[model samples]
Target: MTTLLAASQTAALLPYPALAREIAALLADALVRVPARLVQALPGGASLFVMPAFDARLAIAKLITFTPANAGSGRPAIQGDVLVFDVASGARRLQLDGPTVTARRTAAVSLLAAQRLAPGNAGPLLVVGAGAQGRAHLEAFAQGLGIREVRIASRSAASASALAAHARTLGLQASVADDPERQLADCPLAVTCTPAAGVVLRGRLRDDAFVAAVGAFTPAMVELAPQLCRDVAARGTIVVDTPDAQHEAGDLLQAGLDVARLPDLRAVVLGPARPSPGPVLFKSCGWAGWDLAAARCAVDQLEQS
Candidate 1:
């Protein structure tokens, strides 16, 4: 039987520090082994992305579905599954939930960037958007990074309030504050995970604020303003998930950033990132390698339990 792990089951196991560290290591390895992420366009203007990574015996692949039409049809904007396999036999070992894997791994990647860029101590966190990505980021930054307060920003007041309520359940001080600039007043870290067609945050942030955005995957959408992008590029450095960020990250593309000018996770993970006098911008276009790593971790946990 092919074991199927639902989103809740896989997600419940993600809070473990050991698992998180393991996935982070895998992600680092994946970045080196797989330099580019692959995407396949499906009919109906949808996309299928394949991200895979492995060592000698085991391999995992994340197959993601992006259907823009599912924006509010009860279906998710992103959907798919993670497949764990035995390399020698080419046999499927287990099936893990896609959204859960993507959510956890994406947040883990954000934390990795923040760990390298943000200050060592905890600071107020600002999470833009109130969707799944937003909620996941709230938990990750608060529980994983020890941030005590989180400001939820969204276009919908009810959504922000709901996220704030969820945050409180996690024992973090949280509140809804729509203004990104206002949220950044006392915060040193912000993560934006929306699908806005235009800019979500602009203007100058604190001197060393850590900004990580996972939204704006298409050329038509953007979350980070050109000013912020240019400022980060000029002042500090812009680190991305893959070398091909310019293709998917509309934020970088619209900012007039040259793909060669951006620093990728490969170099950043190997050692200390480049010097930066200003805030560090870590923009991720959702690499499949991350999902593969996260699935491996989830499978290990499931087998042990």
Candidate 2:
């Protein structure tokens, strides 16, 4: 019989950064991307996705669901399940909770993107949300970058402040952004962790700025301003895990960014190591392989424990 695990169980077993680094390495090895297949529902909203990938080593399949309304109920906004199987015999290996995997993978990808795109030892990082995912991003990036400064920006300054205070306990110099966009002038790197339907990085920022946006997967939602996309197009390369998905993502869509024109992840060297040409932008459209890869890491941890 296949063993079933819960999100809480997975949480207790896995360390966020370890899972993130493992996933990042897997992705760097030419693992396929899983573009989320979305389905819009009634009064509020939800989405369903089937993520599948295979190589000579292993095969993974997962089903993920997203319900924004669940947040008020103190439940995760996104949740899912994993069905790991043997590639040679198609025998089921194990079943694990999906939510923990999603959050970790999302954060891990954000960290990997930051490492590849943001300037080294770049101080004064601005995180644009204070929810679970936002906190995860802050933690993973701090571990990966040894971040010197971090500022949390949210619709509620109070919540942002609270989150910043929490980070301080983790040995990070964090605080809330009194004026998020204003911080952009001084902060070299900015990360948008919200699901806002409109732009959050407003006003002017220096030309040599790196922005990593992991919000608003749909074509109707956006966190980065359209002007920033235009700026990156002019001065730096806009890196996307999948350009086709970005075409559907709201930030680029609302900006009227030509999806056909933007460069894909394959086009850029996430590096063996190099300095960015200018201010690079990395956009994520919520892929399934990321979740699967992170899940694999969590499962390994559980087995060891």
Candidate 3:
């Protein structure tokens, strides 16, 4: 029987650090992302993505969606289930919370980008957003990048302070920034983890900064300013989880940023290391394969336990 798991229970079961290592290896495989289909509704949104690789080493064919009303009502923006199947026989092996998988994979993949895309000796990090994804990115990046300093920003100063305080306990030089724009002046690596509809770092950035925009996924949601997109497209290379999704991202399109063509995460990696280039940008639009890989890692650990 497939063991049932709850959020609290599953949280305890999933090991973020170990899963991240596995995810890094999976991401480096140079496989093209499988296609995803969207089904939109007035009150909610859903998508079905099929992530397949040779032999189905890790595959997740599933539906994911979010309901803002439900989330505002103390529910979850994303609420779905995943069915892990054996590629050889198509045998169903495990079932887990899709939201949990999404959170872990999304954070892990972004951290992978940070660790792989950032300069070998990167400096202070600026993270926008103080929620779960923000915290996950902070922790995962710290573990992955050996980051020395971290500054967190949120709509609410108190919330940002709380998150910063927690991060400080992890031995990071952490603090809260009331205005993230001001903090960006000295930051070398930045991660946008919020779901803001407008831009966050429009006029605030150094010439040589690596920014990873993971907030905006849908056609409406956006986190970076129009100018930021233009800057990346013109000056530095912009790496994304998937090129097609990036083309549909509101901020990039609104900015009128034109890249003769966009490159995926695979393009940034040259034998598991960041390619030599100018400033860089990596946009993460959560993908199903990452969730599948993360769940597989969690299941492996659970079985060992």
Candidate 4:
């Protein structure tokens, strides 16, 4: 028999600080030995990716797709499923919702990084792109990262205003930023979740601020401008979740930065994070191992309950 876990059930599994810690620990473990994620491009600018992760007792595979155009259709830009398997028998154990896992785990990853990288004074968090990922980050931050105030901005006024209202219901002081560029300079902590084909994030970030750019996975799409990347690099280390970020992070690539040389979150999360001279920037190209780890955690919780 097979069990199907939906998006809501997945949300119920990991709450707040627990979700952030779980993903951080998983990445920390992966640093000891990381697996390569395979990415393939499909026709019409879509992409399919396979992420495989395992430990002594369990193994998991996740198949996810990236459709940049889906944002306008009321569907997610990314979606897929996680397949859990028995390590010794190689039998598939269960199936989990892909979009939920992606959104939840992605937010957790960014929140975890923010805790380590963002200064204590970081306030009124700025979120660019009022989409699924943007809303997820708002929830994750309000619950665990100590971010109480938030500013939501997007190309769509309805989407931005809606997310802001939702954030307020969560007890977060939230507002819609009609002028994203002007607000960018005041935020010490920010997250960019837009699926922009060109530079959507412009203007100088606050000194000693931190920004997590989760979109722009393809080389052609960009969310952060070159000056922002250079600014972060000049002040602090630019962190990536995986080494594959060099090839996958369009934000960093377009900035003319040496993506291959960027240090990963493995080192940042596993150990104590020290203060940086300037700002910190975390660029994520979504890892399959994170899905595997998140699924494993959810399964364990399900069996326990």
Q: Name the 10 consecutive residues with the lowest summed lDDT in model 1.
A: 27-36
Candidate 4 runs further than 4 Å off: 30-34
- lDDT of model 3 at position 304: 91
lDDT of 3 at 240: 73
Clashing pairs in 4: 80-98
| Residue-level lDDT tens digits of model 1 in 1-305 | 56787888878767635445765677556333443557799989888888777666567777788887886566888898888887788888888888887877888888877776675438788898888899888887876788898898988788889999999999889988868777776888899988665688987877778888998777678998888889878777788887667787888888888966677776777765454677788888876666666756766777788
Candidate 4 lDDT over 1-305, as tens digits, reads 56777778778876657777777767656332337877898999788878887876567778889887786898777788888877778777778888888888889888888888776544788999898899998888888777789998899999999999999898888989987788877788888888766677778777668888998776777888888788778867789987888988988888899988888887787667565667788899887767766876787777879
Alpha carbon lDDT of each predicted model: 0.78, 0.71, 0.70, 0.80
Per-model TM values vs. the true structure: 0.91, 0.86, 0.85, 0.93
- Badly placed stretches (over 4 Å) of model 3 are 8-14, 27-33, 42-59, 70-73, 120-122, 270-273, 303-305
So what's the TM-score on candidate 2?
A: 0.86
Q: Rank the candidates by lDDT, best first.
A: 4, 1, 2, 3
The true-versus-predicted C-alpha distance at residue 266 of model 3, in Å, is: 1.6
| Prediction 3 global C-alpha lDDT | 0.70
Cα error, candidate 4, residue 234 (Å): 1.4
For residues 1-305, could you state the per-residue lDDT of candidate 2 as single tens digits? Answer: 56677777766555666865676666666645454444546455777767776544456777777787775476778777877765678777667677776666777777776766675446678888888778877877787777878988888777798789989998988888767878977787777888665688865555666777888777778887888777777776677766556556677777777766666554554445444577777787776666567656755775787
Enumerate residue pairs that collide in model 3: none
